[model samples]
Target chain A: MTSYIHGEIETPVGPLPRIATKWTHLDRWGALKTRWSVGRMKYRVRPGIYAVGNPDRDSRVFVTGNFKLSFDHLRRNLEGLNCWILVIDTKGINVWCAAGKGSFGTKEVVRRIRIHHLAQLVDQRKLILPQLSAPGVSAHEVRKMTGFTVVYGPVLARDIRAFLDAGLKASDEMRQVNFPLFERLKLIPVDIFYGKQYMLIVPLVFLALSGLNPQGYSFDLALNSGWKPVVNLFSGYLAGCALTPALLPWIPFRRFSIKGVVTGWFVAVPLLLAGTLGISLMEKVSWFLMMGGLSSFMAMNFTGSTTFTSLSGVQKEMKTALPAQIAMASLGLAGWIITRFIFI
Target chain B: MNRFVYLTDVVTLELDVTKCTGCRMCLVVCPHAVFGIENKRAVILNKDLCMECGACAKNCPEGAINVKSGVGCAAGIINGLLRGTEPTCDCGEGSSSCC
Candidate 1:
């Protein structure tokens, strides 16, 4: 029970948790932390009916995923309005992503409706679902199963009031999913931390491996040269996870891998110019390849977060790029290790 | 049109105008504005814009649109490869797959 839930309300179905329209500072803070991947999985409201303001049987029944962020958005947008919210269990995942996984889906929606006795709870046979849920929830199927006519709401939760005020009609722009710089920025933290374990393990291993050379492995040499690979790897992470997304649209090439490699080189080249890369040309090239490939791989994963990429396109790119990336990274690693052994 | 377009000519989305009943449900559900009604029938305005979400195909009453819809996520693809299943993001509790 979060602070958002004020009290309980008696309904025909049962006593349901009541949530407030305004978000407290703590609740707002939770959203920020969730964006940073803290308590992300556990951030969910109880899946069922929640009353916003005082709602009667005639009130609008809005549907949303149980993920707190999704629920918060819907409830917050419903400020000063009377409504009944039907929260579907999405395993603590947001609507769009959960819908993609089929958890915030037709079956789950129907199951919640039946278990909650929604038909008895409301007079109108309507369930206003977020438009993004359409991929998982077939309106026709919901109509057939639960006799509830599904109305797709605007893509953004903030537009919910306007959509309702406009008599459930979304303007053309309301349906569009825009990857604005701000929205892309929000996703940056999560993507950066996506491989936190790898970030740590790789660097520590590199620090130890930096001791290697033709004569013998030396701790003093490791101490002197260890920070070089660390800088390269971290730069790769930032370029792919942060810079690539920030400059996604302006970057050349449609494939995200090429885009990442471009950004990766952009970041790595600065290090080369500063003389941090290495003394040997082979070592410098190896560092560039490793950093660029690391960035390209990270940015390729970003296709998941993007709004416009098709499954076919991603699959095609992965089929070609994945092997190439593996080879590039492997060869770079081999080359770096070789530089430690033979003069280049 | 979205300024953030991806690879072109790669989407599997196919719209059969012959089966379109002019209900325009695809227009309502399509997040990318992929389908448009021309001469009282649905036509794909930009096939490349389609994310293959399958919303249009799923919501179409006439079964006029067809595409293999799934997550375009690389980690999901890798998970599918490892598990020998379709691309899924259900990597529960501390899984690397983003929500």
Candidate 2:
């Protein structure tokens, strides 16, 4: 909550517990640090400016969203660099998310610069911002409003030092956004956190029903209805958040939703085939319907992550897709219920 | 232009040609290259490509441009609708639950 300037710290040296710079195979330490970091940043965000190191008037100033996870990751990766952290009031949203929402935008950035009187603190009229933020903020407008030149930095803050040292030039790789395993893994918790309640509630209800009903009927009921729902939920969430982001470019299809649909199909086909091989025709049909619905619904969830689609386009999509999804889910549920009661 | 079913109506996207100063700012900033300058004036050669990122609107000095811009995602929109907020690119809606 406390905002800080550059000179507050007594030591010029940075904090301990450095983020591992070496790219290694995912291990216990990486997992531990990631989980701990995500937990610690659980929306502990207050919108204000922060100083990364003991920066003087001459040091560089970098702009970012107030999301603690984004802020922490950016600062932790700075290591020994002296810089001013100008956090815009993005309501604790990360840069990419905020940009998509227009919070990490031209108006907010300009407004923050004025509100904080950033001109007085820094001698240079330059601000290093995340390149992804370009979609939201107009560099020309920022300069016109705040008299500061907006320099789009690397996509990842971890590469800030390298970028800064290299005469404020970003390499091609730095400019490209990569959703490798670590990046994809980090996003999973956020997705889960948002959907966990819905996820847990549905399953628990089924579990309760399974316990209450007669042995064969209840067991059959739970297995028939509950298992697929739970599986679909997991499959959908993973498809949208994990698989969509991780295998972004390689997933094929230009639209993000299509990419997610492809991933969902990959998951669904295997399961459907497996179920068909082992189960009755009715069960197989139910599985097919459930899988199709789950994949489509999850694919729909991915419209937000892609570079394509407009707000109007998305609205039009929701108007069409959401109802269809609901109908599919409803039909799937009805099919499952009928099968559970009559067949089993 | 051959009408595509998915494309928003041409009338829905009104580009005030009079307000345009022919700076080509929109032409350069647009990721999709939606706008193309013919002579001095900018024209929407492919509005379908518009993701509505607001790069054109934000940089437009004369208040000449507007488009429905926001996080074009189903989850983001659903979250917005549930909150009774009109979706157009304001991420933090005074709650941690929101994006």
**Which number leads on DockQ?**
1
Please provide, for model 1 over A1-344, each residue's C-alpha lDDT reduced to its tens digit, 9 standing for 90 to 100.
48988999998888988889999998899999999988888888888889999999999999999889999999989999989999999888888888888887889999999999999999988889999999899899999999999999999999988898899999999999999999999999889888877877899998888899888888998999899889988998799989999988899998999998999999988899987778899999998888888999999999988888888899999998898788878888999998888751
- C-alpha lDDT score of every prediction, in listed order: 0.89, 0.63
Measured against the true two-chain complex, the DockQ scores of the candidates, in the order shown, are: 0.76, 0.34
Q: What TM-score quantifies how close candidate 1 is to the native fold?
A: 0.97
Clashing pairs in 1: none
Clashes of each: 0, 2
Off by over 4 Å in 1: B93-97
Give TM-scores for every candidate, taking all chains together and pairing residue i with residue i.
Answer: 0.97, 0.70
**Model 2 DockQ class:** acceptable
